[model samples]
Target: MERKYLYLDYLTCIGCETCETVCDFIHDGSPHIRIYVTENKQYLPINCKHCDDAPCVRVCPTHAIYRDEDGAVRIHEDKCIGCLACLQVCPYGVPFYSLKVRAITKCDMCADRREEGLEPACALMCPAEAIQYGPLVMVLELVNERRAKNIPEHRRELGEEELRKSVSSGYVLL
Candidate 1:
């Protein structure tokens, strides 16, 4: 069965990269995070999206990637062949080759934390209230609200060609 998945809010993010740092701190006790922050003009922190139809699940040759009942993708490190095939096909680009493990690793959505009914480490540690973990409907509603607030008034709505674009980017495994 498919349940809700975690995601991030790029607009609320201040590009502090705290999410990345926090994940690293919790997982490795170092400054190395699975998630990365890419900031040019906007503060976009890149992380595993845990997609509805994850490519990683499909592309794993050893069947290392599998979805739980709640639709969370988990990597079976033991089953991984370390062929880097998942890295090639993942649209979100979450999987990566970990030299330490000699296998692929990606965001598990803080599975241990979730088991305790807590939010993902990065989501809980977001100081800006940027990262939200909830149902898709709720998040989309929040995004729409933010868009309404950000757009200027006294400007006549333009055609489809004039619609402003939202922050758009995906993860990249490296």
Candidate 2:
């Protein structure tokens, strides 16, 4: 079983937030994934980094955080005290307090979906095909191919000035 990775093509994202929406719909709360709008108008989609040397797994006092067999850094909610220790240790701050489940949780690569041989909702539903999910090499290859063509670069709209201004308003941290 090859470890899978998710890649977001910044240039291809339309900032529709569909990925985030789908995740929240399934998870029934705030997203485990997020889309950030950069000052340069790039959309940055972020999820768990699933580091080989994961700090969360090492630092969890209750041993709640662990790497799944599929290479996702996952939280064992039953063991979590919601101490937020995982958040502190995470460089990317991927885990979040989920009121819906009353625990800290992060992406498990949509484990149930993956077990059924399905891609994560974010990657599957992205209209722009910005989020690629698969084995690391395949994901990188797809993203690089698109980048080479400069495909789906953000475009200026002649109309909808107000909407554009509102959407492009502020600088967001990646």
Candidate 3:
């Protein structure tokens, strides 16, 4: 299966946070996507990068965190022992101990929704279309369309390096 990707353009994001609300509603109150405000006052959308070599998958001693058939990094709730290994290793800080589920939970890119032929709530609900979900090439084209518009020069390019430069780009997760 061709891997689908989710991308965000910070420039077009109006910071309305409808994504967070929809995510919570869909996921039984545990939001997998978070919107953070940087020191520069930009709305930084943080979710799982689901890296090619996922550190969380490597560090999980219990094998609870693993990549699914669709290539999304997922936590097997039944196998999780609350070791906090995945939490420590994830660069985006996407995983968190959910008191409700009693396990480390992160985004699965709305897998259940996908099974029913729906895109992720965040990307679908984003009013400005800042968040995009589709084939990587198509998404990247959409990203490049807004390349130099209303963006700070340093962050004008947030391609595949989005995860790597997140912190240095002045996004502080609160």
Candidate 4:
């Protein structure tokens, strides 16, 4: 199945929480998106990866968690017993027990809005154009293009030794 995912450009994000605000507004004032700013000012917006073999789905005793047609991992509120098995197993820590709903809640990629051909709230609201939604291949292409253009000039100035160290440490210097 061709599935869409959210891709973020850490270089472009300005740490603005417009994405968080819009998500909160969509989810009754409880934000599902989290933005983490690194010491180097890289803005990392964390959300559910919606893994194909989602641990959340596997751990749910009630079978409340399931993947939708678009490959979005979703929770059926009616079946959720709130045992938190899904929360415990999710690697991303995306699932949260909602006291109001008495169930587990997480990002569904705004499935309802997507049904109407709308982008996820975060992508639609990001002012920096840092967030994109599409098939994985397309998104990764964009990510690579942006990273190639935005390699910090300071890294390039650090000479071959630092450049090799950075690359070895999993920093995408290119």
Candidate 5:
């Protein structure tokens, strides 16, 4: 199945909380998305990658976390036991224990809205058009394009090999 993933353009993001706000609203006041501001002032929105080899799914003793047909890692709230295993194993730290429900909650990529053919609320509310959702290949292409175009000025100081390593490692080059 062709799955949709979120792509955030740090270069284009203005540190506005619109994505976080919209996500909070969608998830009953808990924002699954988080924004990090770099020392250079770039805003990086971090969320679940929904990895194919999701460690969260593997570590869930109660089988609460499972991947859906669309490849999204979903949490079965009723099945969650609040063990926090998913929180510890997820590489991106996307999963969090919801105190309100005393269960685990994470981004489902707006699965409910997607089923209705609507984009994720965060993507729709992004004022700078920094958030995108689509097939992984297309999203990566956009990331590469924006990264290439936005290569920070400080990266010019790096050696050739260093620059290559930086780009390959997804560093914004600055």
Candidate 6:
């Protein structure tokens, strides 16, 4: 199973909250949102990292969270005890309680849609192209290309290096 990752460009985020709308659309049946967008002076969207060393998988009391063959961290809702252990262990705080199902849920990286070569709902609907999906290596290269060209000389206090590093880390985790 190939690993997949998501990339984000904070500078491009319009803070429109469209990602939140699309998340609800994708999970309309259960109305679950494993991914969501929020603003803190800047548009910020959060989602499950599906960590290479997933804390959720380790902490699930019932073995309810496991990575599929394709490398997606998925929840077996039927086995869930509603313990919320995964919710507690996740460092990124991405998972959310599903009131409709009485279970915990988080992003599966749009695994089903990705298998069909379609983009995740948020990535597709983001009007500013702030969100992206692809192989991690490819996305990193693209990000580097953009960074080299656009960062201005006077904005160094924003710390391009630190910002780039943080964003890259976020991509790998997502």
- As for TM-score, the candidate ahead, 1 or 6, is 1
lDDT values for all models: 0.69, 0.77, 0.79, 0.81, 0.81, 0.70
Worst 10 residues of 2 by lDDT: 150-159
Candidate 3 vs 5: which has more TM-score? 3
lDDT of 6 by residue, 55-133 (tens): 9999888998988765668888889888788888888886677777777877876867877978677778889777777
Cα lDDT of model 5 by residue, 1-174, tens digit: 787777777667778888988898887778889877779876677888788788998989999998887777899999998999888988777888889888988888889998998988988889988888888898888878776665555365777788777667555544
Predicted structure 2: lDDT: 0.77
The true-versus-predicted C-alpha distance at residue 66 of model 5, in Å, is 0.9
lDDT of 3: 0.79
Q: Flag regions of model 4 displaced more than 4 Å.
A: 36-44, 150-174
Clashing pairs in 3: none
Structure candidate 5, residue pairs in collision:
none
- Best candidate according to TM-score: 4
RMSD of each: 6.0, 6.9, 7.2, 3.7, 4.6, 6.0
Per-residue accuracy of model 1 over 19-91 as CA lDDT, tens digit each = 8888877787533234443455555667677787778788777899888666678889899989988878876
Clashing residue pairs for model 6: none
- Evaluate residue 149 in candidate 1 and report its C-alpha lDDT on the 0 to 100 scale: 60
- lDDT string, candidate 4, 66-171, tens digits: 9887778899999999898877787777888889899988888899898998879998889988888889888889888776663576365777787777656555
Cα displacement (angstroms), candidate 3, residue 95, comes to 0.6
Using all chains and alpha carbons, the TM-scores for the candidates as numbered come to 0.76, 0.74, 0.78, 0.79, 0.76, 0.73
Error of 5 at 159 (Å): 14
Instruction: Give candidate 1's whole-model lDDT.
Output: 0.69
TM-score of 3: 0.78
Q: Tell how far residue 24 is off in model 4, in angstroms.
A: 1.3
Q: Supply candidate 2's per-residue lDDT for 29.
A: 68
